[model samples]
Target chain A: NAGVTQTPKFRILKIGQSMTLQCAQDMNHNYMYWYRQDPGMGLKLIYYSVGAGITDKGEVPNGYNVSRSTTEDFPLRLELAAPSQTSVYFCASSYSGQFSYNEQFFGPGTRLTVL
Target chain B: AQTVTQSQPEMSVQEAETVTLSCTYDTSENNYYLFWYKQPPSRQMILVIRQEAYKQQNATENRFSVNFQKAAKSFSLKISDSQLGDTAMYFCAFMTRHTPLVFGKGTRLSVIA
Candidate 1:
């Protein structure tokens, strides 16, 4: 299994610009998530989906949006990007949601810089 | 809200030696899961080991073992006979049924030969 994969290993966006971070997993997981990690800080959740076409806001979802069109893909959209959004983004997936002992599989992460 | 803390910002150990990374968490739920993830320069998050809350026996995977204290709310990773390949940033994470995983700031561990 290829596990989880992310596109655009690195990117730089201008202030007020918009972009999407692509994430895909072949593990056939039902739960998918997007998280951002700032320098020297732990990762904060951005958004997640329980299954296809079911997305919800996470702890730090103010500047971001997500869509889960299929079980294999969950993309994060940043609208009007700000300097505060400069961070490494990670995508993860699990076989099931809470109450199960499934471990999350994380992608290599996309490094984004906002100028 | 659940929180995980890794007090040690950095640590180093000689090759073939043993090192322990400390972690503590706060949560009201009794049944949950704890995980240790390693991120190397490659930036991929790798699962090192995991522990289930209700299980009394500690979890071990090859050279990695965890000392889980349910009462103290402490979970520590012990790397025995460490190798240079083990150098990475290790994060302690917590998750309950139906909730996303919460991660600690992480501890950078360097294995020197």
Candidate 2:
């Protein structure tokens, strides 16, 4: 299984541009998340979905949107890319059930640079 | 809201030695989960270990273990017999049931040869 995979490992966009970062997981996890890691900082949650057709905002959700139409794919859309929006984006998934703890599995990450 | 703190911004230890990284969290909730994730130069976030707030017994995985103090709200990671591969930016995170993780700034650990 590929676990969690993110597309366009690297990308550069000009200010005011728009793009989508694709994320897919083969683990069949019920929970998917998007996090952005800034330089010398920890990953900040951008968006999360408990299951298909259900989504919620996390700590940093501005300028980004996410939709979970299926169990394996979660794509993050940046409507207007800005320098402040540039960072390393990570996609993570975890199984949710009767258990209290959900261990998150992360992707390799997509490095985006908006000039 | 919960907050995690990693006081040590940077730390180093010689190969084969043991080093402990500290993490403290603030949450009124009595039940939750804590995690320590290692991010190497490659930038992949790898889960090092996890601890349940209700479990008094610490969790261990090979050379990586956690000392979870529920009362103090402190969760420290101890890496024994450190290897060069242990070098990475370690992050401490917290979460309630079914909630997203709240992460600390991170502590950069270097394993010297």
How well does chain B match by TM-score in each candidate? 0.98, 0.97
State how far residue B10 of model 2 sits from its true place (Å).
0.4
Which lDDT tens digits does candidate 1 get at residues B1-113? 89999999999999999999999999999999999999998988899999999999999999999999999999999999999999999999998885788999999999999
lDDT by residue (B1-113, candidate 2, tens digit) is 78999999999999999999999999998789999999999999999899888888999999999999898899999999999999999999998865679999999999999
The Cα error of candidate 1 at residue A115, in Å, is 0.4
- In model 2, which regions exceed 4 Å deviation? none
Native contacts retained by candidate 2: 0.64
Off by over 4 Å in 1: A97-99
- Model 1: lDDT equals 0.93
Candidate 2 lDDT, A72-93, residue by residue in tens: 9999999999999989999999
* Candidate 2 C-alpha error for residue B30, in Å: 0.8
Tell me how many clashing residue pairs each candidate has.
Answer: 3, 0
TM-score of the first chain in candidate 2 relative to the native first chain? 0.96
